[model samples]
Target: MKVFTQFTDEEVRKAQVSVLELLLINHPLDCPVCDRGGECPLQDQALAFGPGASRYEEAKRTYRKPLPLSPLVNLDRERCVLCARCTRFCDQISGDRFIELFDRGGAEQVGISAGQDFRSPFSGNTVQICPVGALTATTYRFAARPFDVATGDTICPHCGDNLDVNDAWACDKGRFAFSFVDQPTRLTTPLLRDHGLEPASFDETLAAVATWCRGGRAAVLAGGRLSNEDAYALSKLARTGLRTNDIDARPFPCDPSALPAERAQATGGMAVTYRDVELAKLIVVVGLDAEQEVPILHLRIRKAARQGARIVVIHPRRTRSYDVAEHV
Candidate 1:
């Protein structure tokens, strides 16, 4: 078939519609409870281009969306615009087609075929792209609002060895993973093994910590997941304030003498934005399993495939994403 490289007058006419919005009139207005409320593209679009009033009736279509899509994400069909962004993501990016759209017409909606729990590792991205609150992250649900929360933009404190900060990244796990911090069995207060682990006064706790520091063999072990500033403060406290030679924070082995290789290679890596991935003529993965790790990336790669990118997979599970690619 001959390709239409440029928009023609007839094609433009066909694309026009009397509808004032890109979504169905039956969609819900649950932006408040939705995880994507602050950053949703659909909400933004509605403000600028939606009709003066909804054309839908209460009886036309109804469904309460959204249950968990996976451990990291949830799906609420009630708020779905049926954009299929989530479905395409699992099928094309995560290389796991655990979820799909079901039924047809106003009955049209998204869901897992067998009512099974979603188990994809990269399922978190589905919550990130859902134009509506249809998909949400389990870790972030009701944890805090984007506005109520404060973020300290700092560098990746890669194992807390006084690393340099070039670019700042948003905290997904820190903000969302509350189960670890708020577990019912968690020790919320300092437990004096002798004092019944009561909620001790701040001064009393400081004194105990100071006593622990008085000994010369005191060592510190830091995790890479710490923010750079927090790591630096810990390192400084151990080496300077405590005068201990046993200062350590890294939990895993590293070649820390050198810059973090993954970030260092970012400039040369396949650093394609969602839009760029959607527009690429060919998308090639270099040992990257987006579906297993980067669901948003996988979704955009799928979008590119839908738009005609020749998708090539250099990996195994990638055979799935590649199927969505033109030349798989």
Candidate 2:
């Protein structure tokens, strides 16, 4: 079979219209009620190039809505067009064959195997890649529409041990934690606890905390997830403002004697980047589980492997990257 790789803009539009027509044949037009409504690719494509009218007057197929694929991920089979993108992602990228096309032809749809849950570290990627609202994050389902929320860029704090800020990608925690910003119970202002916790002015809260800190030995232990700016601010506040040397940013306990060595590795003149991984003749991944620890890095290494580059992983347990690596 011959495949056309290139096409004119007009041809592309016509193709898109035909594609959307078939996709929408059994798809429910419940955009207002869908979790991916405002930010959906089909939604955008439909507006840009899809046909204004449907020729099919037949009734749409129906199924049980939103079968639970996992605790975090849900599958709306009706919205699925049997693209197999999610299944392919699981089989190729994530190495988790949890979901697959169960039935054949028009009845074909994405589904989790019997006695299996979509329990992959990179499961959310499937949700993000679903062109339609076939896959959705359970926690974020119906939480808010795309236009109803604001977005801003920030660093991932999940893996704070890595000091190189330029190569960071959003882990599951970093991607989903932003939802808390819209939570009603989230703290919006400083609180003072004298007899009981009470909302107080920033100045008053700072003054009270300063007074208490000065009265006794206090230490500021920051989490790895803090942004560079926030970490720096906290460090300044601890040393200059609080007048204390008892401040540390490492969330997990590490040997004090190894601090300088670790710092050197983090800020060294030489660094291994995504490009380096791609071009390297020999890549050795130690202790690090790229699938869970750094999925983006895993993708880079996988690409390199496909290019005939050799990879070696040294770990007690096998990782998803091991599937592509030359040796484990």
Q: Rate the local accuracy (lDDT) of all candidates.
A: 0.62, 0.77
Tens digits of per-residue lDDT for model 2, 122-167:
7877888888889999888998998999976555545543334344
TM-score (all chains, Cα) for each model: 0.51, 0.68
Q: How close is candidate 2 to the true structure, as a TM-score?
A: 0.68
User: Model 2, stretches more than 4 Å misplaced?
Assistant: 1-18, 47-52, 160-169, 177-267
In model 1, which regions exceed 4 Å deviation?
Answer: 1-15, 18-59, 64-74, 104-107, 136-175, 178-189, 195-199, 202-215, 225-244, 251-328
240: Cα error in model 2, Å: 11
| Distance from true location, Cα of 248 in model 2, Å | 7.8
lDDT of 1 by residue, 107-216 (tens): 88888867677776556556666777787777678777766777664532222221222231112332244356567887666755454546776788888888877856
Error of 1 at 74 (Å): 4.5
